[model samples]
Target chain A: MTSFNAALVRADTPQLTRVINGYPITYLDSGATSLPPRAVIEAMSRHYELHHANVHRSVFQTASEATEAYEGARLAIAKFINAPGGAEEIVFTKNCTESFNLLARSWGRVNLKQGDVVLLSEMEHHANIVPWFQLRDMLGFEVRFIPVTDDFRLDLSNIDELMKGVKLLSVTGMSNVLGTINPIKELSAIAHKHGALIAVDAAQSVAHSVTDVKDLDVDFMCFSAHKMLGPTGIGIFWTRKEILRDMPPFLGGGGMIADVSVDGYTPANGPTRFEAGTPPIAEAAGLGAAVTYLTGLGMANIAQHEHDLTGDALTRLELEFSGRIRVIGPRDMTNRGGVISIDVDGVHPHDVAQMLDQFGVCVRPGHHCAKPLMKRFGLNATARISYGPYSLVRDTDMLLEALHSAIGMFG
Target chain B: MAGLEDLYKEIIMDHYRSPRNRGELPTPPAVCTEGFNPLCGDQITVYIDVTDGVLKDIKITGQGCSISQSSSSLMSAAVKGKSLEQVQETIGTFKQLMTGHETALEDGGEPEKVDIRALGELAALQGVVKFPVRIKCAVLAWNTLSQALSELPS
Candidate 1:
């Protein structure tokens, strides 16, 4: 096993040095949003200070520079994801939620009809489920979900029936709450076997591990930059260029037109067709820097480091707290990322999180935008803590101490 | 730490541990109204039986955290057997207490002490103002009580 230099990674992240409540901040909520490194911040600031102009519209030097940075970020993301269709497939959106909306509105609206079905999983984030529900109201398509098994994996027992008549299967590559990494390749194979196009919500997965869209054979993939140590206002929506050419534009205004007349407007070709209005120029630069930084550290090494930390925490928590706290995700390192959801007996997650806050251990306590999944497990909420490249075992040690105090108070 | 102590006062924790008037009452004579904290998934249903402008019985049933459930438990006990006017006054005082705007009004129209004696045990929740995130948790039951009251007649 390759060892990781977590202290070196932490040195790059300025937020890791912050102290709260007289204790060094133990940021365990990276599953919710990763703290950006100084390099990402500097890159964004450089773009804004040196080259600040709207993309694809103006004829000046800064405009060309802005456009170059924007499109260059798309190329960076393409290489990061190993996107088979390359930079032409990348469309910038407000966030991952908007990217899902683009799929539901543009591709889904065009392909799906009244009798068609869009199969999703129980572990999908609300962003993946809600858009299809909204489209269902308009297009009259049926939406079905694959259930989760008791072992904290997607229950595919009835997948054959679930996939019958399904035109599209949209799922999360990794659960934001559970940290269960879904087998996208296997799921995509099944979806294709049933003549359905597969789309992956990579919001949680892309940051933690390597994501090769071509290898997974997913037709569409979307993720947010903020979750991946980048700026908040940017996300990437990648699809096959041929499919994007046929799909209608989701949002319309300037910068997405070929020719406009009193009669109508012809939409632009390729990724720019869906990207209307002024995009997040500085955010794109930040994302470009983020991918560069992640590549420098190496995605596989980051995953291995996180897995070791997560695996250690899991063992320590169960051994120390046994029968007192239950983990909501998988117990082992196999087929999982660093996201850990803990259910402390006889205490509400909010109260538990509040107690942890005193010790400067930041953890998210809520449904985590996956309400239906919460209902599946008879839980309203759980305390979710995840890892990024910079997260350390010492952070998890602080987290355990906090959890012990919280349990002593409430349990 | 002071904020945490003030938030989890013995009275509040006692109410949470052994809630008062926790279940539903017989209805038709009783009218129930529900309110939910959408963000945290705290749903509270207040059941009130008003006979001739007096609350005959008050009960609250819900699933929520300590603050919300305890607030509801304490409120149900406080509002029971009180007149409609007294219930309204308590709700107003509680809201003002949470917001820290105008605490209480003396008969002379001066912004003075709240006469915490009037609030009885519900005054234990006065420390909620310090914890901004918990104000709503402390007020979910009061909002439902207000809704339940408006459903009653003159």
Candidate 2:
């Protein structure tokens, strides 16, 4: 507990010191986008200041340095997730959304055809659902969902029937709205038993836990850098090198083509086949720095600190608010991450969020881009308070204080 | 408490807790349209029975924050007994207050304050205009009303 110093992490983040609404900034919206640490900021800035050039094709010195930095980031990310294929398997895209698009447009479009089923959990983010549906629209494949239980956990009772004819089992590792962490290895095992390739939407889980792709035995994994204390405009898509090598290129452009002629063009091999244009070089540097920063703090510590905080907050909120506000996510800390979604009786999420904002406690209020899950819960929206590695118990105290004020004002 | 009171004026809360004119009007002849804010999932359905050029009856129903629900309640109260033209005028004044315009002015130029007195308790929502985020909440019902009126037999 002493080793997990949120104060030190807070010090590394420059945004934590600022004042908002005459109150110290209590950021509880990390589920949307995490605040950047000085390490990430400086790495990106340093890249622009010193090493700035196009990647892959450049032969010059700065170009080679940039290429190395970019490749080094791939290595770092691959290692971070403990990917078996290492750097060769990691493909950088615009964000997690683009990564899913690549998987659906390239792999799903090529491998899946009519009657092929794609199994998705009901609680998946739109990033995991929409791309497959977009492909399903044209391909005529059946998209089935594993319904969520009333207690906010995935229902697997009918999973065997649901996985029939399923070509791909694409699901979120952790729900962005519910914070329920799915058992990835077990799900992968089930998907494999059903002869379906599994893809993990690691957008929420990758930042919160130890993500070992090899251990989980997942075929494909995608996550956004911004959610993991890195820069935006960069995301990671990981798969085994052999599978990625054979898949047709998603976007055909300069960097993605090995040979181009007036009559025809040949797409490059490996992950580069997917990366279309000049990659996010500076962002790669920021991601690399973020990797180093997280590595230094140790992901296990970050996970533990946030878990304790979440357990504490849930206890306090339930005890204090009691009948006023009900938690939408798992009440137990086990199998759940740091996301806390709550429904205030007789109050809208927008009102709750606005009242919280008056006290400089930022929390996201909406469907959280999971409309199906919202409809599943019969909820329009819920006020979500998410924690980052830098978040502390004090943030939770301020959130509760704001909650009391908001409830009192309405009463 | 100080900051919150400005936003959730007592009158606003009263109207929110018990919104007036909330329900589906009988059947046809009464035009109804729904306004939805996709960002926060706030939705409002405005139902109006316009006989000839006058609003014989109007109802505002939806689910959302206090500002939107209360604004809908007050809006239904204000426009229920007014002619079509008068309802349009009230809509313009509410929009001006929310967007900070000159619908408050009488004839000559006075202060830039909103015409809260004319709008009645509806003017209590003027505090929302300061919060750029909540501006849409205050005007969602009014927008739905306009949409509903647009479809009214002309």
Candidate 3:
């Protein structure tokens, strides 16, 4: 047995914790939005304190510095995700949802015609599915979904058949509810072979694992900063430079246009074309700092730690609860991330979550924005406990104890 | 263990184990409306048979958490055989009670105290207010019933 120690476990430090949650709060909702680390918090604070000026207009020192910092953040993000080109290919948006929406509205509007097919996975979060639905309603395109197997893994065996006649294939890199890490590299390759471009919702995977746009060979990928221990209200969209240059701008405003007139207007060059308004300046800096921090700690280490935690939790839950607790998704940890969804017999997920809350143990309960997946699984909802770098064995113990307490209450 | 007593009172368990008005009423005259909490996949289909402004029969069928199921079970029992106005008033009073707002019915009135004994099982759900997220679960059935009544054509 591996003896766990609590002495070395401290998340976000004290100062950063104050600004975020106002106390030493145990935040297990990292999959929703992670608690920002001290470096990220300090970076944003420093930006406000020293260089608080708008970008791309004023010739003053502060304005130039602000522009440099903001553009520098773009460069950092591009590097972090291993984009082939420079920052020019990276577009900053409100969040992952907006990024996918941008692609659907702009790219889908231009490329897809009536009866054109856009394929998706059953495990997609609402963000990925809903945008396509809106596109289908507006543009009269067909949206098809790749079926998930009985074990909840994407059924890649039928990819060849599904990819046929597909204009674009959009899928999630990792399922928020199932914790299934999709084989994006293989999926993208198959989509390409079938003459289709692929867009990946990396909102869950990018933060927890090493992700490279070049390595995956995906046409487009989007993820949020907040999920990766960065500030909220900022996200990244990494696309091929040539594709971005060809696609129409999502939002047309002062920043996105090179020349505007009553009759016609031309869009600005590079990623700035997609950024319509004044961006979230401080938030971008915080994201850049977050990427820097993650780089220092090494994402591989974080992924390994999360994997260990998930594996241990899965083993213990199965052992302790026996037949009473039914874990959703793949039993093996190889193709999974750190998320664990479990249904306790005779106990509702809300009751389980509430009981866990009383013990100061946090876990997410519900469909987790994956209603179709829940329907596919024939379950209303399941309680999900997702792990981060700060999660320890004791935290899992607290969850087990609270779960037992909740079950005993129903008994 | 916090024990079953704290969260699920005996009354609630009783209602859940043996729910009242748990099936469907007759059609045409019965107004059926569905309530869904997309966040947790809690769904309820309320069937109310209103005749001449009086709720002659009421039945509910759906799947949800215990709080939702039991609340629907109790609500069907409480409002059956009452006039439309009385049903409306009871629903309004219950909404106010659940939200912790002051309700005139709590004091003396024509409808009286609503004889909350049928709501016996539902009282355990009062603790749901403390767990604010589950408050929706507790109120889902009543909300659906309210919709069914509002949709009635005078």
Candidate 4:
């Protein structure tokens, strides 16, 4: 048994109370998004009830309060990720997809040219892959993929050769489908050795592990609030202050500009240069509370908690299902998270997900926005069950119960 | 609150388990068109061999859930021996059945009830509308079939 009491954490999540289809909701889709705790909801509601106003502009008291709430969230997020450049390095976007788009459009266009190469992995979600491909089409830069090994690890054996002519190495810190925890610290060193900048998509790993940007030494990192017990509509794009200062602003609008006229305008300094229009102020308040909640839980404890759950679940799944089920990710617990994608013999993933839904067990069934990886494995889709800090062993027990029924039904 | 039985009717499951006309035909003689539900990565390739305005043969080759695969099987069985005009009528009625109330609402009138009797065995898939997300899975092969018919050498 793990030291961390996930049932206690689950009690604070209001969504856990709901009963679906005559059964309690067994939410196992945290890889897609996490459920916000009561603290996050209350903080958001409090912002709307007491201090609701537009941020950064008005001289009035409420506006300042709103600005403080918004900026305070940035500070909390910066501290959460241990960003060396502090809040100045954090640029808010719509979500992790927008963050990657900002990185590709702003930094990519300026730095990369015809002969340059961008190295991405086959395991990357479409969010990380599509933006660079979109940029590569316009910039005429070559894009290469680091192949995935048969055992579901990044084939870094040819890393040195693949890194040649690669100006940027972009990869996910943890695969949403496979739950493979990448070696970001080592990859960062390899990228630097090849004179290429590295970007880590921490969208999946941010909530499950401790992400210190300083220790990783990654040039860029991106994550979303919704996947980390926070509200939707807000995400973070973090880079060093030096790189952020040099890169041009992505979206052109009122808040992003330093000075404007009929002629071309100069962009503002710091993170605000990229944040145009009204930002997600209410969402930011929720995110701030979420950060505080996660900090209180202690990230190390959450990591260990998930690690224990994953090990137990993997062992049970193999023992119970045997030949009927095949895990699509690494069997070993080392460098793995709580994501478990499985392919049931003779049953489609969608069908499995549909049956699980009958038991009120929420699991995602699809390619998981990682079609390249799916193609690599010769699979159309997989039924993926992921975990959050609130997830418990009983959840996996319910999952096993549901899977037994699903397979029996299909049979 | 429709149960799993409603979505996966006995006849539908039978068709899914042992799909009819499950392989592909030669491309030169049989025109092939593909449809994809990108959301779930469900793909279908529809091949049809039409002669003298009659669909002599219809085959389905794809990978998807029961809803999609079974719907294709049902569709192939229904249209394989029909004239082009009859096949077009069946397609119209099936699409109407799938659309349910949306078509009637668009015309600003009473909810035009789908006549299930007219749909024959295809009516077994009517429960798919209760779950909106699965509707795409049911219609993917039909869309590809329609595309193939439209592109037929006229």
Candidate 5:
């Protein structure tokens, strides 16, 4: 197995070399979107330079090459998640948000009905929650939330009770705001026990953990490529082959059909039915290279590295800013990733983030698109500092330094 | 390019630390309007007591960044006892201040001609124009106050 070295990873990422203000950039916002390495960028550039053509529509050499690259990306992503049905299960969308929308509009329209319950969690990002809510508005389904405990974990104490009428249990694999890595396997078991199919929003967890959809026993998984060291404009929604076959098309136009007539159109077989019009060919190439790069470095090693960084940073943040800064997420390293949300006393997150910016530390400040979770915690916003595979201890050190400066300025 | 000091002036921080006229002023007697910046979750509520075509009393309430809260506080102090026409002028000036002269001209107004001295301490928030995103935070209070004024029973 190749050893995971953050310095080597940083060297490969062109963004890491950037300087902000007068200081070297300390990027700790990877939970929002990860920095792509040179390999991913070069792969995309190469595709655009050489083989820029629409896939599946043309028989030309360049078009075929583009199709091969695009299909190869789907296979790589399928393998990355250990999808049981492989490439046939992977459907590319605009982003993770679109993936959830596709799942809700297509699968939900078919299966869910009036009085059917769709269970979600309070800590879920808006992408996972809003689509279901929108669909519920139309289909007249009841949407219930799994409460978050005071300790920043999903309150599974009443999971069995919550899953009663829950035809579908959709939750985040890891919270974007809380950095709480949820027990997907355990939840999947409970969901099945309650006769509910489970879908996971793996936008945060997939990059920081080794995702095996088979092992997790989840029926559906949605994640964005941008958050997982890939490019934007491409995301994956993976499900079992039987489920994909049964689910209807989400966006209906071009490329997604076998035959189109004046009367009606028959949807294409497999994942292509969901992918309408020209796909993100260059982005698919970038995602393919990202998959290769992550695989080469080893996901296990990256996970461990991020775990150590998170644990250390959490501990240091607690010790140093004991009364000043309160961590909004789980303090324990167990079942957590590198996303750290902190609320500084007597300081708004926007002000704190602005202060940190002066020190060249990039942190995200806001509700993190988790309004329900923010309300649950009675917090408008928190300044979140997240880590990536390329992050190092120095990044945390920079964050701490910036935090001290911010507090000093705001205090 | 502007530094932190430019955004968080001493007067602005003072207003944020000790916000003036902060509390509810009874909705029946005072019209309360809430302004929200969905981008950052910064919110401000403005309560205006209009007495015979004059804004007699104004109170600011809500939670937000320093710029927002301070802008609300400064705005409350500025327009507390002003005539309706004067309050309208203040709102227009503050909005122009946040958006800058380019937008003012784009809206078919005069050039960059907002009198800085007329804004008084509100001019402290002028630096917000440098950081485009925070302009919303600075103007949220003004927008809410404008709403409150419009809602005043004529």
Candidate 6:
């Protein structure tokens, strides 16, 4: 076990302790969206002030500079994820939801036949499930779900049974609700052995730990920038080079086209073909700066910090609450991330959340967009307290105190 | 200890612990409407049996936060025996109250006041106005009632 004795560094994050309701705020809802660092905000503001021009169009110096900055961001993202075959394999979309929709509309429409099976896990966010459901309704494909065990882990014991006729396996790298980290590399290997392509939704995992796409050998992966201390409206969809070359274009617009005529149209190749119009230039630049910030701090260091925090939170919660609270995910930090979903006896989740808010402590209460997983666990909802790099032990203490207050009120 | 009393007042907790009209109605010529708040996973199913221009009976069955469930129970008790016009009028007045308009109704010709306590146990939810996120939970049942009425012929 890693001891959590690190200093509560307040140098990097200036807005850590904003006042809410006449009290210092404790933000524990980073799983919903992360607060951006000063570097990312400044980078975005700098782009808007200068070097704001359309790329790949003009021969002027401004256009050239803008194009270099935009493509440089792409390369930075590629290296950030250790994407094989360089920057061209990265396609920028609105968010992870849009990225999954693009794949469903483009590659899935072309490759999935009438009887082909599209396998998904029960722990998927609605973004991952709904697009495939829409595709199934339109394209006549079969949708199947991988069952979860009693402890909220993926039931890998029945992997062969579920992978019999699966053509494409879309799984989450880490469950947003349970915080259980799935074995993406092992799952990818299994999918490949069964002659299926795997696409991992790394929305929760990419922010907390290091994700090397090439080493995992996943066919496709998508994640959003908002969850990673960057601005919203920007996410990455990384596909293998060969897969990118073979798939049809997702959206047709100004940039994705090579040449257009009344008779025929030619589409641009690789990532450009997927990006249709003027991209989110400032947001992408901000995401690039966010990657730089994370790299400087070292993702491994952040992961270790989060792991220690999660362990501390669990130990404190279990010790204090004893038989009152039940945590939903793995009890060990070795197999989990920094999210903790908890249910209190005889207390509704919303009531718990409301009590926490009275102390200026923010948390999320609901199914966390995993209704099927909630059904599997036989729970209506759970109150979740997640952490980030800016979180401190004081925040956890506030949460514990507020929870106790809530329980007393109910009692 | 700022416990459930802060959010769930005595009356609200009473309705939650033992909800009124909680069972499902037999499938009759009833109009059924479902309400869901995606943000909080609060859902409700309301059934209205309107016969001969009167709301014969109103029942709701679902699971959600205490505010939502108790509000539904109170809503069922308020409009069960009222006519269609009365139900619509009460709904409009309740909507105004929830949206910060018409905080108090006029009383006996003196603009002095009409207490919302006259609105029955539903008045217990006034505390929800302080918590905006829970406003939806308190109003979900009324919204379902409006939907059920809208589907009727008048």
* Local distance difference test values of all predictions, in order: 0.89, 0.90, 0.82, 0.94, 0.92, 0.85
Tens-place lDDT per residue, model 4, A290-398, is 9999988888899999999999999999999999999999998999998999999989999999999999999999999999999999999999999999999989999
For candidate 3, lDDT tens digit of each residue in A22-62? 22334466788776777888999999999889988889998
Candidate 2: stretches off by over 4 Å: A1-3, B100-112
lDDT over C-alpha atoms for residue A242 of model 4: 96
Residue runs of model 3 more than 4 Å from their true location after superposition: A1-9, A13-26, B1-8, B100-125
TM-score of chain A of each: 0.98, 0.98, 0.95, 0.99, 0.99, 0.96
Expressed as tens digits, the lDDT of each residue in B49-136 for candidate 3 is 9888799998889877777887888788778899988888777767755675324324432222334564444455655544445668
lDDT of 5 by residue, A1-411 (tens): 566788999999999999999899999999999999999999999999999998987999999999999999999999999998889999999999999999999999999999799999999999998898899889999999999999999999988888888999999999999899999999999999999999999999999889999999999999999998999999999999999999989899999999999999999999999999889999999999999999988889999999999999989998999988899998888899889999999989998889889889999999999999999989999999999999999999999998888888887
Among all windows of 10 consecutive residues in model 3 chain A, the one with the lowest summed lDDT is: A1-10
Residue range A280-383, candidate 6, lDDT tens digits: 98888889888888777677777888888899999999999989999999897777999999989877899888878878889999999899998899888999
Q: In candidate 5, which residue pairs get closer than 3 Å at backbone N, Cα or C atoms, i.e. clash?
A: none
**Model 5's DockQ score:** 0.82
Report the poorest 10 consecutive residues by lDDT, candidate 2 chain A: A1-10
Model 6 TM-score, all chains together: 0.92
Task: State the RMSD for candidate 1.
Answer: 3.4
**Cα displacement (Å) at residue A116, model 1:** 0.8
> Clashing residue pairs in candidate 6, if any?
A409-B3
Error of 5 at B77 (Å): 0.9
DockQ of each: 0.46, 0.56, 0.40, 0.87, 0.82, 0.46
Candidate 6, residue A407: Cα displacement in angstroms equals 1.8
Write model 2 residue lDDT over A347-386, tens digit each, in one string.
8999999888888999999999998999998888999999
lDDT of 3 at A255: 95
Summarize candidate 5's per-residue lDDT along B1-154 as a digit string, tens digits: 6787789899999999999999989988988898899989987888888889888998887999999999999999999889999999999888877775656645665446457799999989887877777888988898888788778787
Fnat of all models, as shown: 0.31, 0.85, 0.58, 0.85, 0.85, 0.65
